[model samples]
Target: MSIFHGLSAFPLTPADAAGRVDTGALSRLVQRLVEARVGSVGLLGSTGTYAYLSRTERRRAVEAAAECTGGRTPLVVGVGALRTDAAQLLARDAEAAGADGLLLAPVSYTPLTEDEVFAHVAAVAGATGLPLCLYNNPATTHFTMTDALVARLAALPRVAAVKNPAPPSDEAARHAALRALVPADFAIGYSGDWRAGAALLAGGQAWYSVIGGLLPEPSLALTHAALAGETAQVAALEARFAPLWALFQEWSSLRVTHAAARILGLCDTALPLPIQPLPPSLHPRIEAALDALA
Candidate 1:
């Protein structure tokens, strides 16, 4: 199976207030994902603060996570950066650090044209032998990758999967449309945690999840149930996630997951600066939300 396939759990790159990675905390997070038997481990993704960290720090994050996974789990490291050369170098670093695959997003301050994104993705895909997943996170990347663009990029060598933003409804139509554009085996995954169950039921090949980053067991149960076409089982698990999912919509998944990780005692690190922590008043709600999943 492709590293990007199935339940690829992404973990927050635990870092102190100083923007320095706490590898010890990081290894523990990856260890939990490995022990849960998730299909793969996504390192340095948006949840992992890939946009905030420097190359050296990102490399350190991968080196540490690669060690924790230790070939037991496939490590798909996010190599998204502002510059094509920098992203290419990051891809190289991840491969050298033992990553099994790469996740590239069109990250630019000025909006990127399709031609620009195409060239950028092509360069990074060529940088290493590892397969790459196109990260279509318009909410963060500010560049929305269209289906035509996806089809164009899919033809590039080693571009094997796409982490798309799942639509809330009509997931089957959405999934079928994208499936028609890509290869039969090209992995078409979804990221929005609240919408993942429906996506899976509609044939989404993977769940590039945020909540699964901190809380994997329940997420895995949902993933397995949906993938197996167990409607009642998936609905039950999806209800358990309702409270937390609402929090995610309001506070954003990155901030909520940062809070969720701390609440669960998995990691106590702060998100990189300029992104403030969830106000203390939100703790009770977050607590109650987590309780639902419990």
Candidate 2:
């Protein structure tokens, strides 16, 4: 099976207040996810502060996670950078560090053309032998991979999958459309944890998850139920995590999730400067969500 399948934990980089990657804490977090049996471990993803970290920091983060994973869990490192060259360099570095796959987002200060996006991914694919998963996150990348573009990208060698946010509607039809356009081996996974169950039920192969990063046991149970088409179990698990999901809807999920992780002592909440921690006013609600889920 592709490393793209099932629950892939998207962890926050456990950075300290000094803006340094704490490899020890990061390894421990990876250990927790491994213990929960997540299908893969993703580092330097959106939740991992990829855009916020410097090149050196990003490289270190990948190396640290790769070292900790040590091939126990498949390591999918995010190599999304504004410049194609930078992204390619990260891709090469990730491959050197023993990453199982690469997740590339078309990040740009200005809008990008379809041809440009295609070339960027192709270039990265050429840079490394590892499989690549295109990240379609318009909210962060400002570049939405349309169905036409996705079909074109998926045809490229070494482009194995896409980590897309859930579709607006007719998700079943959307999944069917992609399936028709791409090869059977190509994987389609959704990242919006709120809609993951529905997307999986619609035929998406995986849930590239933030919630699973800090709390994988419950998330994996939820994914298993979704995959088995056990509607009642899926609904119950989604409902159980609904409070935390609501908080994610209100504020940035990165802040809320990091706060919750901190409360649970899963990792520190020291996000890189300017991102800010979850406000104190929201503490009780976070506490309540954690308590409810606990």
Candidate 3:
């Protein structure tokens, strides 16, 4: 089984004012996730600001996460880049660094045909022996994997799962189509918005969770309830997170999530340049929403 089969939190990499990684804070963040009993930690994914960091910074961030996690939970490193070689190199580095798996998205802004997407994933799979989870954030990558492509890729030995953002309105059809593409052993992880509990109850087995970054307890609770066939409890927990979910939809998700982390005492909310802090005007309302969850 892939190490990334259950609830996974995509943590934001904490950096200092000088742009250096705050390893101490990063360690604490990882420890908190471990304490929450998250199944995996997806390092340097979108929530981790992978695109904002230098390659060296990314490596150091992964290493720090691994060190802090200390084998308590699996660490799945993000390995998507505009260049295939770069993505492969990151995958290799992640493997060498002892990451349990890789979460890959297509090269940024350059939309590939379904065949090319498969080739990209195939190349990464070939480059590193690590298990792979395809990340399909169409909002960012502008590339959506067709059900036919997912079916073909599912047969590959290393392609273990796909992390798709929940599509609008017709989630049931989307879930059914994706489940039909992959075998019973393979999983479809939900990443976008607050549909994770519903998706999980509907047969989605994994989640690349941004909300979990701030509220690990509730997030894990929702996942556990869904897994245990407690759909009503899951719905109750999802209701508590509804306001934060609404905020995520209104603003830059990355910024708001990081800010929520800081408010929750999880991290410092320092992002690299070009990715500024959440607006001061929104802090009171955001904090109030998070406090309500508490």
Tell me each candidate's TM-score: 0.98, 0.97, 0.94
Q: lDDT of candidate 2?
A: 0.89
Which predicted model would earn the best TM-score?
1
Whole-model lDDT, candidate 3? 0.82
TM-score ranking, best first: 1, 2, 3
Q: Clash number for every model?
A: 0, 0, 0
Which residue pairs clash in candidate 3? none
lDDT of candidate 2 over 15-55, digit per residue (tens): 77766788888888888998888999988899998888777
Better of 2 and 3 by TM-score: 2
lDDT tens digits, residue span 30-64, model 3: 88888898989988888887877777777888888
Across residues 54-149, which tens digit of lDDT does each residue of candidate 1 receive? 899999999999998999999999999999999999999999999999999999899889999999999999999999999999988999999999
* TM-score, predicted candidate 2 vs. hidden true structure: 0.97
Work out how many backbone clashes candidate 3 has: 0
**Ten contiguous residues minimizing lDDT sum, candidate 2:** 260-269
Model 2: per-residue Cα lDDT at residue 81: 91
Candidate 1 worst ten-residue window by lDDT: 1-10
RMSD of each: 0.9, 1.1, 1.7
Off by over 4 Å in 2: none
